[model samples]
Target: MVPVRDELFARLERFYDAIPRDGAHTEAFGGLVLFVRDGAGWPFYARPRLDATEPASAADVADVRRRQRELGLPEAFEWVHENNPELLAVARSAGLSVLEAPLMVLDPTALPSVTELSDVPVRLLDPAAPTFGADLAARRAVAAVGFAAPGTAVGGAGPAARDTALVELPLDALAEEQCRTESGHRISALAELPGQGAVASGMAMRVDDAAEIAGIATLPSARRRGLGAAITAALARRLLADGVDLVFLSAGSTEIARVYLRVGFRRVGTACIAEPA
Candidate 1:
């Protein structure tokens, strides 16, 4: 069933506005909100102020882009299509290409538990473990390759793929993106195959009752074997088990969304991501 549009969007609005408080600060430019990185953690992007009566204008988009240039940040913007459809047009008018991701929320009652793959159990990434450094580097590499390869289609890439990436995937790889400190706000999980290590990886970010499962990816060779969705399920199940009221994610494509659907996530909205042309 579709959720009440206003209620759902409002909940998401609060989730968006509150999430950056942990590692970034929000700056207002007319009807837009830019989450500026403060030297650490995740680098957030600009989003629409859905609660505002008037939609974001082209000038508002230009102003945010100017500030991003001044600060040396990626001139990126994101928002839910239903929140203010015009904002996507605004972003386009400002000449940024937009990606429409399938926004989904888990059906808690229908959520499934995926504990392992081919006997390799899924485990949360331990920052204090002996392999933490290698695992972090490997996870980053896998995600990089997985995203580069795109979609959930299985290929020949696996641990061999990640190991090759680990050759140069520095231990300080966390600096490139968000943190994985396993605190209240952020948590990461990984699954390992025999010989191959950390074949799949994902992270969950919490903001009060809401949690977003993101960066879920599988090694290219490991695709079609259910590893990506397994990692995604493990992360979502963990958050819901920990008392989060809503667990959601943005699927890169319908193929990926179908993988998530089998994990009990139902499409609720379209997450519009605006990036440089």
Candidate 2:
């Protein structure tokens, strides 16, 4: 059998390289491919191209960062360290803070026991569903609320906090979410309260047998209730059931990676994310 590490990075390069095609286009800078957004929406980052063997130069990283500043975009870069180990030094040399997150891959056969979350029902969002029109905005807004505070640590914030954030959630988020779904991804949302809409959500981006679970978040009010894990496991099971062989994600931190570990994902490598210093 091919090594899981090898299989993971090989598939990831292709997945990451191709993901920008939907709402963004790629601009080549040496061995790097910068995912530049076509218009207003969530901005993408730079990465080593699929065919990249040698590490991109520090000049390439600086050039990309300069281009980002010119375009009024964030100086962000993401890469699987094992796939292009030398890029880490290049990014640091460019005066960027590189956070090495746990690069995890799911073991399909060992997924956790998902007890029925009746109170906070989680389900995959379908563009074809009749109720999709009514559901899309709220679910997309939940992500903005969840990500604003970041992490699993809960506080007094909850439903009302989400309500305050709803007005600030841009229409661009909905458009971006739509673009991702149209690009062959499956989005899942969880509604912890009956009267309100979704409070936790995530998506699985798939191409052939490779899928990456991302944007998994639960509202500050709803944290520590296993909502993030539920959304993750739901998306993972959905992808595997549909024949995806490799499912992976990059955790925000080591503590957060433990949440995914409950759902049978193990760290296979490091996911390097670099941003402005």
Candidate 3:
């Protein structure tokens, strides 16, 4: 098996590189937002930005700090466009605290069966179905309301719209083994990405067995019931059974991260955001 850290990093790199290249950027938000912006969202391998305040060889830590504050970029984030030790060191000096690292695991042998929850109901929705329209909106609305309490200005409404557009592509990429399950009408979870005939996270838009969690949500009224964990475990078991070899995902919150951990995931690395100095 590949080293856990290496696998996780490679998975993340694939995701960062896979963002649509036409007109936008996928900013993986956190203490350090990963800015994967390009026409093609190609993964950042190792290239230095000419906009840096100093040469990569003599990078001034203070320059990174100034640029971060000036641009309002996350205090801590990696400019994955290039790979340089000094770049990371400079960002660290600027108050960008480390958070949970990304993680990945290979399960070529398949995941164990997940016991069904007797109490909660699970629903599966077709990503291509027109009825799927309001589902994304509703989920984002609930997410917006949830994030508001934490003092963040996240507009789930927008992602909901973008999600509607991406669904067709990501769904098409999902393997037949990819399946979705939700807990009752209150919380829904889908393997969104397909991997190895099963749903895995991080594989979307281009290949199979590279599944992404596509979407997961709980009704505002149903928060705190642990429905999230139930849905995740159920999904994991189903995907594993389908022959998924590895799985990867990004967490929006520590709470979500903990739940995923309970389902057999471990942390690998974290990303950060930076801007031109």
**Candidate 1 displacement at residue 184 in angstroms:** 2.4
Candidate 1 off by > 4 Å: 1-5, 50-53, 115-119, 167-182
User: For each candidate, what is the lDDT?
Assistant: 0.79, 0.78, 0.40
* C-alpha lDDT (0 to 100) for residue 46 of candidate 1: 91
In terms of lDDT, which candidate is strongest? Answer: 1
State the weakest 10-residue window (summed lDDT) of model 3.
195-204
Q: Candidate 1's residue-wise lDDT over 80-187, tens digit each?
A: 887778887778888999999999988887777785422447787776676766676777778877887898677877776677776544334453333436456777
Q: So what's the TM-score on candidate 1?
A: 0.89
Higher-ranked by TM-score: 2 or 3: 2
Ranking by lDDT: 1, 2, 3
* Root-mean-square deviation per candidate: 2.9, 2.7, 10.4
Which of candidates 1 and 3 is the stronger one according to TM-score? 1
